[model samples]
Target: MRPSTDHPVDEPGWGPLARYVIAATLARTSDGGAVVAIVLMVNTSGGSGWLAGALGACITAPHLLGPFVARSLDTARDSRTVIAAASLAHGTTLAAAVLLYPHTHPAVTAVLLTISGLFGPLLTGGISSRLPAIAGPSQRRQRRAQGWDVATYGISGTVGPTLVAAVSAWASPATAALTLAAGCYIAAAVIRFLPYAPAPGKTADVPRPLRTLTGILASGPLRRTLYLTVTVAFSVAALPVTAVSSTHTLGVSAAAAGILTAAYGLGNLAGSAGVMIRPSHTEADRLTTHLAATVAATLLLITLTPSFPLAVTAYAAAGIANAYFFAATLAARNEYAPDNARGQIFVWVGALKITAGSAGTAAAGALISTSAALPLLLAVALTIASTLLSLAERRHNRRYNAPCGPASPHTQPENGRPHPTGPTDRIHDCSNRG
Candidate 1:
């Protein structure tokens, strides 16, 4: 169990953090590379774009069940065992898919991708659930560890595509897929060697994944966090399309679009660095409001800007706001979620974001031909609506006397026992956790 404290860990070390970060970053990089590789492999093998799209859907659709797959770790004797198995399984599936690619029907490739996608949660949320154990047993250290984890997320999203593109440029798409498969195995080996620590009270009577998800959604803070997540997903999904549209409007080459995208990536890095240096003390509700407002304002500016430079600047600032929004939501999850169900909550949140973002992306694509600025305008409207909803939610909570933190009174405990005395014990102080 995590030692209840408001200070940094006594023995500060980066060994375990480094190990897990490498493993996770490599694993995710493989995931990112495989997507591009799969599309290339299908297209090169005389398959239509529809086949490639179907294969991509196969790979990502299974992530909707990520929480259920991640629940195995919550119930396992040692989560490392499950993580190792998942990593190996992911690699094996990818290898099989690559080997059978052009020789087999697209259905066969889709099946393999679906099987591989089943392990996505282990590479992400499962690793994250171990942060307290990885960083030593203190809240402050855990927060720092999570910061590192978030940084890896930002880095992976950028590095993963670059690695795939580099390998594909040097060799065939099939070869690139094979390389990523090897990376999965290497990540599995690294995870296997890390010290194993069971989640707090591993023997606790954990509820089913669906039940845990339901309990998490019952909390005021978590609900607000989720609300923010949906809005942010919708707002950010328009970036790529908007970048392309802006490039067209400015009569610039594709390089300009890439530059705008890179600006967002740089802003993400900057925001993550700031969070690592000094964590925020704002309430989750207030953070959500600010994040939504910032996104809306930036998108408005981008829409109104006549030059590419101004658009790029606005996008970068929006990216920073987006990163901080995620940081705030992540901290709320850590503070509010019971340890035993943390993996489930994390996976569910990710799934929700992915689903919402996919919808938003599709919408933006459909509308971008009509007007470049139309999607941005829609995003602004959605964000404002979300902010208003969050404010209304807070008022309802205060009116009916909801708990201060995310958890409700009947929320399950990580230690399989009743919560400690005092109302505060049931309500975590998210704004003051440091």
Candidate 2:
């Protein structure tokens, strides 16, 4: 089940990509806002803090189902229909949860929120999985699209929580929840107009979920990307805790923590914009490794900095590296994923990152009381480890005379012919490279 190599007569231009960014941004904004909105809603409604935590669990735990949900989308006859329906379901269920939380049983509210969470991947990875097709077979276009896709995430991360906080402060948490739900609904409406073609004919030998998982593990490029992604996610998740701790250590006002965090977020946005203007020509796998090293270095700088301003500068530098790292991750997915397993690859990787990030956050919380610098140092170590892992794999591939390109032997068909799924014509033996 290869992606169709034939180009459409009316090859989509930036129009479709713009719409995709809009839809993705809206969906992601709602997702980010939901956390703050739920906490505020529960707190204002006289619920215990633990109840809010329980409902947050309901939202997050269903992310484990992402791979299965993605499999359903991958096999659907009309992916657009499936995705749009999922979007609608996400919005409706969330709206219902917000409305019912005050009056209904806690169990009932949890059920509704869980249902919304079940469809969460459709808003994130499901949307991302379509980018390669939307950008056509042109690698340059795909790279540019990846940059914009990353930008949408950065924008949503900044806008969502701020939106929720403002609305909750001025109006009410219930109103904020409804507003977030409306954003989801709007995203669904926008998604329907995108240039998504109907799914191609099903292949007789479509890989099962387990087989797809095996393929992901066996493919060196993908395996390396996922490893690095999870490590980076874990490290980044500690930043918020680290920011607050650093402020306390520096004897600055706690409010300055927001300033430090905003520096990173702004740097991310700047980096994303730079990628959009000048997309990298380097191979995705190689770029990912380089960016990981850069992140490790920048994080190390943060740990070494004694002054708050210097720490903020280091954080911003790390954020820039992270932005490029994330863009490289998307490029790797677009370049290496099998057509039939693409959705699952994206969703499963996302699920893994979410799990790692949660663990990192919990770990940071537990360790922050001891040393403010501990989590940042841990992040630096983890990123360096991930970078070394990638470098070791590349070294192994070279020693074995194997290239990590799409046409690598690992991706060969059972008939012993290379079945390259991505642009690999330019790829050559690893030994021939610098």
Candidate 3:
């Protein structure tokens, strides 16, 4: 049986354990990078565009079912075992991909590709579920966990494509991609094997993942968070697809496209440094509204950007907005959680993200090549979406921030009791009527 509660950093498992946490997270990020690398490799090597893109999707497909799968393991009291198994599965798949690449041929490649890719979701699910157990009950720690994950994704997004280029320069693109991906698995194995203070694991009465997701999504505050998150995700997925396409095939060089992409990343990095902003509350609803305005405003500027420098500035601003948006959403999600079903909650949140991202990506695919109106359409849609989110925030703010004398919609009378408001409190006090 696993130990109850998360282990402190000084625990026996703590030394290797801290490494495990950091490395496993970084490994996960690198593995995600590998997925993108593989897609780019496939694309450049005359593979079907759809097929290559689909391969990238294969790696992330697990997040959709990730929460549920992890929940099942939690129910079984086998979280540690599940994570261990997932690590091994991930490593083995990468090894197998490398071994089979040479002799397997294209026909066999497709057949075995699914088998290797399948481990991705399982691994992600396992790692995600065990985090709370490993991190203890601190909110800051939890945010750290999420931040680590985000940093991984952000850095990977920035560096992965470049790695593909570097790898391909020396070896065949297929070989290089596989080699790099396999390296990540090796790193993951080392990280995963490092000792962790076992957690008895989270047990909950909420048996169904969908049920928790549904309940949270049904709540106005959370539902709006999900919607805005999706909006952002969609816009993000679209920008890379459309911006690159328009710049690349139309009139611009790939170098310029890459520069613009870098600008987006820089913006995210700037935004991610949230500690710099004071009085900066992350009450999910308020933060979301603010970010929505920032990003929506940034995107509005996107369509108007005429030069590369202007485009880059706008993209960077958009990224900062996005980073802040995600951070706020996560903070709020955790704050409102019932405590018993956080994993399930985040999973459903993950699903909403996937759904939103997928929808956004699909829409971008349609508009990237065919129309000038696509980016504008996306920006306009995002603005409308943000405005609605702002409306929700107003509602959210009122509920949480109630008035001084009476509980107005602008504020919640905390403790379900309004502040002592009489003639002494307000000039309009009812006592004056007498």
TM-scores, all models, native as reference: 0.87, 0.91, 0.74
Candidate 2 vs candidate 3, TM-score winner: 2
* Candidate closest to the true structure, highest TM-score: 2
The RMSD (Cα, Å) of candidate 3 is 7.6
Score candidate 3 by TM-score against the native: 0.74
Candidate 2 lDDT over residue span 289-324, tens digit each: 999899889888887888888988887887888898
Q: For all the candidates, what are their Cα RMSDs to the real structure?
A: 5.3, 4.9, 7.6
Residue 367 alpha-carbon offset, candidate 3, angstroms: 2.0
lDDT tens readout by residue for model 1, 1-434: 33223232335477667878888888877766677888887887788999888887776778778888887777887777788788888888988998898788768888999999888767776677666566664445555566677777778788877877788779877888888888888888877655566654555566688897777667666677777787788778898888987798877887799999889888887877777777665554466677778878877888888887887888788777777777776766666667677777777887778778888889999999999889989999998888888777666545444435555454443333222222322334443221
Q: What is the lDDT of residue 310 in candidate 2?
A: 91
For model 3, how does the per-residue alpha-carbon lDDT over 1-434 read when each residue is reduced to its tens digit? 23333333322334443554455554565455556655666667677888776656655664565665546543544444555565555555654554564566644545444554544454443455444444445445545544544454566556666666777777766665565556555555554444343333455464577777776655555566677776777777666765676574335787677777788888886776552232143455556667777777777787777766777888888887777776666655554544455555655665657667777777877776677547646765775677675575555444444443452232323222122222121212322111
| Candidates 2 and 3 compared by lDDT, better number | 2
| Steric clashes per prediction | 0, 0, 7
Location of the lowest summed lDDT over 10 successive residues in candidate 2: 414-423
Q: Give candidate 1 misplaced runs (Cα > 4 Å).
A: 1-12, 137-140, 202-204, 402-434
lDDT of 3: 0.57
Task: Using lDDT as the measure, name the better of candidate 1 and candidate 2.
Answer: 2
